[model samples]
Target: MRKLLLPSLIIVAASLLVIRIFYLQVIDDSFKLKSDNNAIKIKYDYPERGYIYDRNGKLLVANQASYDIMVIPRELKNTDTLEFCQLLNITKEDFIKKIEKAKIYSPRLPSVFLPQLNKSEFAAFQEKIRKFEGFYFQKRSLRDYEVDSGANIFGFITQVNEKLVAKNPYYNSGDLIGRQGVEESYEDILRGIKGVKYIQKDKYNREIGSFKEGRYDTIAVQGEDINLTIDAELQKYGEELMINKRGGIVAIEPKTGEILALVTAPSYDPSILVGRQRSKNYTKLYHDSIAKPLYDRGLLAEYPPGSPFKILTGLVALQEGVVNEQTTFMCNHGFAYAPGRFQRCHCGGGPRDLHVGIYKSCNAYFSNVYLRTIGKYKSSPYAVDVWSNHIKSFGLGQFMGYDLPTGKKGKAPTSKTYKKMYPDWGWSGKTIISNAIGQGEVLMTPIQLANMMAAVANEGYYYTPHIIKKIEGKKIDTKFTTKHVTTIDKKYFKPMISGLFDVYNLGTAAGLRVEGIDICGKTGTAENFAKIDGKRVQLKDHSIFVAFAPKDNPKIAIAILVENGGFGATIAGPIASLMIEKYLRKKITRTDLETRILNTSLQAQYAKLGGLSEDIKLELRKNDSILKSKTVIPKIKIDSTKEN
Candidate 1:
């Protein structure tokens, strides 16, 4: 019986072993996957990025073919390093360093060895690529800009860093990622999914065939093309007008809240950020701190809104019931806050109402109105909070949630902020009366100012300002489609709009009116100061203007800021008027104004504050010559022989 039991146990164990062996050889795929990893070479097929077009379907950005040399460190075999380096136009040291970097990234995974090779370089390397083991060339696309404007808005793409690769599994080593602007904002939509293929290799690492007859492989899906609200011609015109200047201009379609043109002065050609020379050009542009061409001043620069802000003061005064359209006060050139301290005004001393206050830009009238508004509330702190709330309702003191990747939340001082500024003494409206004139603690970005004007044009509400009008396959977020209503009542905007209209007809911006367009605009001159060597020194005033054209049913709203350009009416007003005229009329009737602006260069103003470095000066001088030559309007002859 014992002998029979032992034989039975042996029989059971033998049966179990047979089943396990069958499973290991045929059913289990874990070991098979591991084996495949060793012999299968994976390659990626990168799809071309989507094209970017303007509102009118004019191509703004397109793609051009580029090639990258890729490497898998573990598969590398001993070869002639010097000959390989010479063939690829790289030094031996660079070869060694790149190899080391690839190994550090992953021994088995692929990494870029050399990137962005032109057609000639790719052709030269292709002939000898078969001799190099574990090295291959991958085809890709880089941005080919059709227009030379909007470098700040049409950001460039660059290779992803190790940090980014580690953070996002979707990206691997040597992958290109968008850096800024529309590219960064819509990276996922613009960057199509990368397709992959696994090639079966023999023991000697020779390519045998596609793994599983390419069943696991996928075809690259092309990215979706996008259309922006930008007007390419308008953008180019604005850029041309802004040459040799340092500031920003933002134009918006009032009804739709679509950004028409966003211009930052001192911008470089977007093409400079493409190809093998991208790094070199980027380094030069980055190091030129004096002229930050890469900086998007329209969205990022926080400056006091200056007198354009006076429009808000008038609106807030009316909303709080502290002042009316008929309310009037006297200004003796400025508002005398304290016995010795007076906030100066340029509007000649006279009796001024809300309408007169806005056009004349009377500091005294607004100051009195602001004081009354604050005093209406029981406590100054509570009043400040109320005032802050009213101002912020216009999208001040917070991010406006524009489609751009970057922005500044211009300040609208609340009680909390004032508390931080003055902890000991309790504050009052008089203490912060400078805000009445848009100078003290108020600040706004160019886009914010433009959006505020858009709200006024819309009569009380504004759609969120956005650069993207339509996505190829998807609807824009509801936030952009929904209207953002201000805290002020809709009824209050009437007087405000009237006063702003008066600004063009009878006020500060009266002289710069377009012939037919009834443009409503406010001129501002912000006091510019900087702390140099631990001392506050006043620089030239920054010229500012905010406007909307055709007064009623406005088509365009714009804001222009010219740093260190004295008097808003002198520089910014004309620029805004011209921009409006160009957008509406499609041709400049006032060529004299156009000539004045095109011929005017603020390089001297920039030079005064050490704003121009030697390198920037040289570039500006070269650009100046090119601009001068192009702007020389040629005469049109009457062809009498072929006349109608």
Candidate 2:
């Protein structure tokens, strides 16, 4: 009986083992998947990123071949550390640190050890690469900027960080991603799908052949080409004009809302943020706290909109039936909203109607109109919100929904915002009358200001501003195509536009007109304040201008802001007029104005102000010297090949 029991147990155990083996092989392939992962090597085939062109079909950005040194930590074997470090032009400590980082990322997956190798470096390394184990070269493309300007618009591409890799499975260590502007906004379209090759490996950790006869392999797809709405000539010209100044300029097509030129002063050449030296150059630019070349003031710097906002005040008043074209308000060089508080103005003094209020920029007229609008509602909160809603409908105090990745919703104080500020006693229209003249809490970016003008030019509607004009085999976003109607009725636009036209004809912007172009515009001077020694100190005012050319049939809407530039007509207004003439006539009849802009240097204004640290100030001077050395060409004629 004991012998029979032993035989029965052995038979039962064998039967169970056989069934489990059958399940592992046929019914469940989990073990096979695990085995396949261990025995197969995956290689990536990176495709070229798309080309970028301007609206005139001129090439803006292209790609050049580059290489990277990839390493898998677990596959590494001892060779000559000193020799490898020397060949790569890196210290032994750097090599060790990189290896440690790669191990921390993954022991099996590949990581970038050294990247952006030029042609000569790649050639020299390829010859002796066989001596090193676990290391190989990965081919890729780097951005080749065709033009020298537009760094703020084109943005840059860089390697993914540890956080990004862990968050997104599609990305691995050393994967490239766009960082800002159009590159970031259209990454999916610009960065095409990468191909994968699964190669079978032996137990000895050597590639044998294709895994499963190359069934898991894929071919890379090239990224789609795109056309930008920017005009290369206009963009270059704008950058040239903003050379030594610190500010921003945004130009949009009034009919289509396509961005033409976006200029941020103190910006580096787009080429500097490309290729092997990108990191070093970027670090230098990023560290300049005083002259922030990397900061996009056009989209990010939220400053008071100034007198240009009165255009909206008038339009809103007209819409709400609080004021009409002929309504008059007496101004004594300012408006006394409260007993102790007076909003000062420079429009002289008279019985100013809506026309004179706009063209002459009368403070009392707009302030009274704002008060009347607020008085229409019983609840101050509701009243403020209604006025805020009317303001918001113009796309102010909100994101412009442009194709650029970065922006700020400039503060347009809502009822809730005011409630938090004056929580105890609520608030009154007199307490916030500064909003009538674009002061107190009203702020806007240059792009937003330009978009607002575009809306005014189109008579109460605007297409959301966008940079992409066309993408290969793909449609643009519906938002850019759809029109956003303002709360103000279309009828109010004609009257307001008349006031704006008079601004160019016989008012504040009278001297800033282009010869043949009927430019309807507004001039503004926003008071500048800075935190110095833990106290707010007033600096020179920032010059601002907003305009749309050929008032009857507008084509271009532009906004410019020059930091610490005194009055609106002094700097920003001339630049706007010049930009309009250049775009429309394709030639600058005002060479005098062009020369003034080109020769003027606000470098001292920027370096001295802003409460910059001593080190940052020194760095700005050093950087300026280097920039001058590069840009200042000798009077002697040079070879055309070396002109760029």
- What is the C-alpha lDDT profile of model 2 across 1-644, one tens digit per residue? 98899999999999999999999888765455334276888888998999999998999989998999999888888869999989988898998999999888778888899889989999999999999999999998889898888888989999988899779877777888888988898889898889988888899887899877886679999889999999999998888888777789999999999999999876787787776788888887776555667789899888888889989888888999988889998989877788898777678899999888888888888889999999988545779888889889888888878888899999889888887898888688988888888887888899999999999999999999999999999998898899899998999999999999999887998887778789999998877566665656566677899999889889999999987777889899999999999999999998888888778777666555556567655565567732421121001110110000
Badly placed stretches (over 4 Å) of model 1 are 1-36, 533-535, 610-644
Global lDDT for candidate 2? 0.84
TM-score of 1: 0.90
Badly placed stretches (over 4 Å) of model 2 are 1-38, 609-613, 625-644
Report the Cα lDDT for residue 533, model 2: 58
Stretch of 10 with least lDDT, candidate 1: 635-644
Model 1 C-alpha lDDT per residue in residues 1-644, reported as the tens digit of each score: 98799999999999999999999987764455444377887788898998999999999999999999999888788868988989877799999999999988789888999889888989998998888988898899899999888888889999999999889988878788888999999999999999988888898777999887887788888888999999998998998888767789999998898999999887878888888889988887775555667778899888888788878888888888887788889888876777797777778789998888888878788888888888898655878888889889888999988888999998999888888999998888888887877777788899999999999998888988999988898998788888888888889888788888888888888789788888888998866566544555566677899999889889999999987777889888899999999999889987888999888887766655533346555654544322211111011111110000
Per-candidate TM-score against the hidden true structure: 0.90, 0.90
